[model samples]
Target: MRVGIYLDDQGRSLDVVVEAARDGAKAGFASAWLTQFAGWDALTALAVVGRDAPGIELGTAVVPTYPRHPLVLASQALTVQAAVGNRLTLGIGVSHRVIVEEQFGYSFDRPVDHLREYLSVLGPLLRGESVSHRGATLTAVGAVDAPGTKPPSLLIGALGPAMLRTAGELADGTVTTWTGPATLADHIVPTITRAARAAGRPDPRVVALTFVCVTSDADARRGWVAQRFAMVGQLPSYRAVFDREGVDGPGDTVILGDEASVERQIRRLASAGVTELVALPIGSAQEQATTTDLLVGLNTRAG
Candidate 1:
């Protein structure tokens, strides 16, 4: 199984993101992922990381499709891919209504249809082809060729049924967060796998994200984790995943313990069919570094 690190580029500076991504690559991580929040744009940060770490695979765990046009996004992704030598992965999503509607001043109604249309136009545009189509959500005419290689593999951040089906039919894979192996095996994996097979495509890659804090003390670990969970539990979409997994909260899914325990947790995810696992380290800098090192060491497992 491939292991990567997911960096929440919310409050961190661009330099910090680049430094961490460089550290991840130097430590032998397979990839470095950047997730969108309120601050830096995902592609922008990824471009910086791409320039800073030449060999590392850079990705956006998710960039919402509501605000930006698909062609614009595809062009930006292609640019980053060009800079990084085809080591860029694009993960796009229809974000929550609160953020899309309340934050971005966009309509949240019929997001799935919007995404379907976005991908229909996005695919060809990213592949250096002109796309002129009229869809329920997006319409475009002509395309400009960006100075880049072929398009990066497109992954959709999806949890719901319609989104999952769309991901399987159109995208290269699915990127998920706030989901444990139980929920993944029982719900997410089956849904996406079924969609891919039904579409006559090979099994789509399942990339799962989880938080980890490598600490020896139980209370310290639990306390550190509970705080993170408190924030995640407040998100309705994340709450559903926790509920499906029979987890009381984030602590139930977080990998917090000694090295042995954390390693076992990762193995569990692999058994559940997670092809790529992205670990988000939450805690003090030291603890985060420990978790990062542990993940780097696991790259040997791929050998």
Candidate 2:
């Protein structure tokens, strides 16, 4: 399985973010992905990454699909893809209710329907084709200028059944967080792959992001992890996935332990059909570097 690193979003400057991506790439990591949130836009961050580190794959853990139109995303993704010489992966999502509806002043009803129509317009617009559709939620009637490179791979953050099927039917792949192998094997993987085959499409790639901190101080590590779980447990979307995985909370899905245990768990995820693993190191640079160095070494040695 391909191993990548997820850059931290908290209080990071553009230069710092670029440097982090470059460091990960030089450390033999396959890719460096940036998570989108209120603080930074994914495309802008990746443009910096493209300029700073050539030849390394750059991606958005996800850009929310509610506020921005897909045409805007297609244009920005193409620009970044060209800047990176086609090494960009545009991962988009219909984000949860709290952010979209309560925060952004957008209605949260029928997100699945909205996403279906959104991608319908996005696919053609990204492919440099004109799009004109009158759906229940979205309607678009033009195409953006294509960048020099073809559109980057379109990945969606899907955890639910309808969204997973939509991802298979339309987008190139699905990216996930806080989900486990059993959930993937029994629910997500089969649902998506079957839908893709039914549509005469290639099997969709599955990339999962999870907390990966390597430290002997289990208490400190658990404290770091608990903070994340507290927030995630409150989210209705993630809680449903946690329930499906039969886990108590998001902390259960995190990959935290000694190096050997972490390695074994990641391999189990790969065996369960995860194509790429984007490991999020949840501590300072020194701590992150320690885990990252070991993981990169292990992956290279395995190769």
Candidate 3:
């Protein structure tokens, strides 16, 4: 399976982010992805990174879909693709109700419907086709013109069955988090693969994102994950996945241990049908470095 690195762009300068991406590329990672949080703009920062870091793929772990119109997002994604030499993978999703409703002030009703409609408009625009869509949740009446650029591979952040079906039918694949290997093997991989086959599309990519820390102090590292990402386990979507995986909390999903143990868990993910593994290295600087080096070595072996 392909191995990638997820970079947290929170509280960091663009130059620092670019250097990180370059380092990932130099270390032989297949890709580098950034998330769309309250901090840096992921696509814009990736465009800057692409100027300095060549060869490696650049992607957004996700950009929230509710905030931007399909037209606007397509334009930005295509622009980034052009800037990145067609190395952009656009990962998008309908974020949680708390963020969409409480913060963005948009009603979070029938999110699956929203995702379906959003992709209907987004897919065509990314391919440089004019769209005149008028659906219940979204509408588009224009096209994005980005010459000399191919459509970046589109992935949806989908966990539930309906969302996975939609992602299989519409997008190239799904990007998932907080899900374990057993769940991916029994539920996620089969459901999405069946949907894609039924839709006459090729097998969809299953990109699994998880926190990893190579440490002898496994208990402390797990506790750090539990404390730092406590809110994630409480989120409804992730909670459902946790229940599906039969895990108690976000810390359980993390791959934390010595190098051998951590490598074994990652191999389990690969055996479970994950097309790619995106590692969010966690813990102290030394621990993070150890995790990255292990992942790089694994990636090299895979290649």
Candidate 4:
């Protein structure tokens, strides 16, 4: 399985972000991911980083689908694909109600239907075909200029069964967080693979996102991570996943331990049918660096 690293979005300058991607590539990480939020647009930063780290794959852990229409997103993704020499994996999602409705002032009703409509237009557009798609919720009438760019692989942040089915049927795969190996092997992989087989598509990719920290003080580290990432567990979709995984909260699902323990868990995830393990390292500066160094070593050793 491939290994990827998720970069922190801490208001770093563009040069700093690019330099980080360069460093990640030099360390032999297969891919580097960025998130979309208030700080920096993931795709834009990836575009800038592409010039410096052209050999490494670039992705978004996800960009929200509500604010930007699929046509618009496909346009930007294709542009980034061009910049990155066709090494873009466009991960997108219907973000939480609090962020979509309350924060962005966009309606978050019937997201499954919305995603279905959105992908219908977005997929064709990414293939360089014109779209005149009209659905109950979305209408995309034109295609953007993507003359020389190759189409990017599309992934969805699907947690629930319905979303998983949709991901298998429509997209290349799903990216997950706060989900453990047991839930993935028993539920996620099976459900999505069944849907993909039914749709006559290739086996969908399963990208597992985990917070990694090689430390003895796991309980203490969980406390710190909970302080930073606990709100994610409150999101309805994430809560459902946590419940299904038999976990009390997001902290329980994190991958934290010493070097050997962490490596064993990563192998278990691969055995659980994960195509990629995207590690989001967390902890103090020294711990984070150590975790990253181990991951960089894993990229070479595991390969």
Candidate 5:
């Protein structure tokens, strides 16, 4: 399985973020992903990073779909692809109700339907095809013109069965967070793979995102994670995933241990049919460095 790092660009400057991605490439990571937060735009920052960090895949662990129209997103993604030599993976999703409805002032009703319609419009546009879709929740009436750029690989942040089915049928794959190996093996992998096969598409990529910390004191690191990321377990989608995994909170899903133990858990994820693992290394600076080094070593061996 391929290994990647999730570069957190919450409060850092664009130069700092680009340097981080450059460092990730120098350290031999296969890819570097950025999440869309209240800070820097993930795709824009990646475009800049790609100019300096050649040969490394750049991705958005996800950009929320409600805020941007399909045409606009396609234009932006293809522009980034052109800027980055076609090394962009556009990961998108219908974010939680609280954020979409409360913050963005968009309806969160029938989100799976929204996702399906969104992809229906996005896929053809990314391929430079004209689209005239008029679905229940979304509509598109034009095509993007990004010369010399192919469609970047598309992934949706899908957790439930319906969303997984839609992702399989329409998108390239799914990007999941707060999900564990057992859930991937039993529920996620099979559901999406079957849907993709039934839709006559190739096997889908399963990219699992999780927190990691290489530490001798596992308990202490887990406590740090719980305190730092307590809000994650409260989000409705993540809460459902945690319940499905039979875990109590986000901390329970983190890969926290010494190097050997961490390697074993990551191997379990690979065994569970994960095509790629995007790790968000957490904890102290030393612990994060240790975790990243372990991932770099694993990536080298995989290469």
Candidate 6:
């Protein structure tokens, strides 16, 4: 699997995100990703980030698609692409109900329909063509005005079968979080692959995100992770993936163990058809350092 690192970008400045990505690349990570948190916008930050580390792939685990019109997002992504020499993967999603309806005040009704329409507009615009679409939830009548060389690949944060169908049809692949290998092999991989083959699209890229902490104190760290991500199991989309993997919560899917154990589970993710793994290192400072050291070692060994 292509090993990537997830930088902590919540509420941090663009400079910090860029710095962290640079640091990760220097540490021999195959790619580095940023989340769509409250601080710097992921793609926008990557405009400058890739400059700090010339060739590393920089991606957003996702930026919510509801707020930005596809035309607008396409333009922004293209801008980042042109700036960074096309080292961007635009991961977009119809985010959770509370965040969309409550936080952003956007209606979360008919999300699958919304994502379908959203991708229809987004795909054409990314290809440097005009999109004139009018769906139930959104409309776009224009194309992005940007140089679209080396078009960034698009990934949907798809968890359910319907969403996976949409992603396989329209997007380059799916980006997943709190999803384990069994779920990927049994439910996620099959659903998306079937859809992609039916649509005659290229094999879908599966990027799995799992929290990892290389620690001697596995149980204590797992307890911390459970409390930290306690709310994820309640989220409908993530909960579905958890249910598929027979996991009770997000914490259950985390890959927390000693170095050998952690690497072995990571290899299982690859076996289960994960094209890339965006490892979100969790735990205390010491744990983080140990995990980073192991990841760096793996990258070096691969090289």
Could you list the CA RMSD of all candidates, in the order they appear?
1.7, 1.5, 1.0, 1.3, 0.9, 1.6
Q: Please, what are the lDDT tens digits per residue for candidate 6 over residues 1-303?
A: 678899887767777877888889888898888878777778877888888988788898899998898888998999999998888999999999999999999888899999999998889888898878887889889877775466799999999999999999888999999898999998888899989999999999999888899888888877887898798888999888878788788778989888899999888888899988898788888889899888777766655
Clashes (N, CA, C under 3 Å) per candidate:
0, 0, 0, 0, 0, 0
Candidate 1 Cα RMSD (Å)? 1.7
Candidate 3's C-alpha runs over 4 A off are: none
- Give the per-residue lDDT of model 3 (tens digit) for 81-139: 99989999999999999999999999898899999999988999999999999888877
lDDT of 2 by residue, 1-303 (tens): 788888886698888888989888888888889888778787888888888887678889899998888878888888887788899888989989988988999998999999999999998888899998888898788888865778788899998999999999998889999998899888888888988888899999898998887777656776767675688878888899889999877777888777787788888888888888898886666777778887797667645
- What's the best-to-worst order under lDDT? 5, 3, 4, 6, 2, 1
Error of 2 at 140 (Å): 0.6
Pairs of residues at least 3 apart in sequence or in different chains that clash in candidate 6 = none
TM-score of each: 0.94, 0.95, 0.98, 0.96, 0.98, 0.95
- The stretch of ten residues in a row with the least summed lDDT in candidate 6 is 294-303
Off by over 4 Å in 4: none
- Residue lDDT tens for model 1, 182-213: 88888888898999999998999999888887
Residue 294 lDDT (model 1): 87
At residue 75, give the lDDT of candidate 5. 98
TM-score, candidate 2, is 0.95
lDDT of 4 at 157: 91
Return the clash pairs for model 2, or none. none
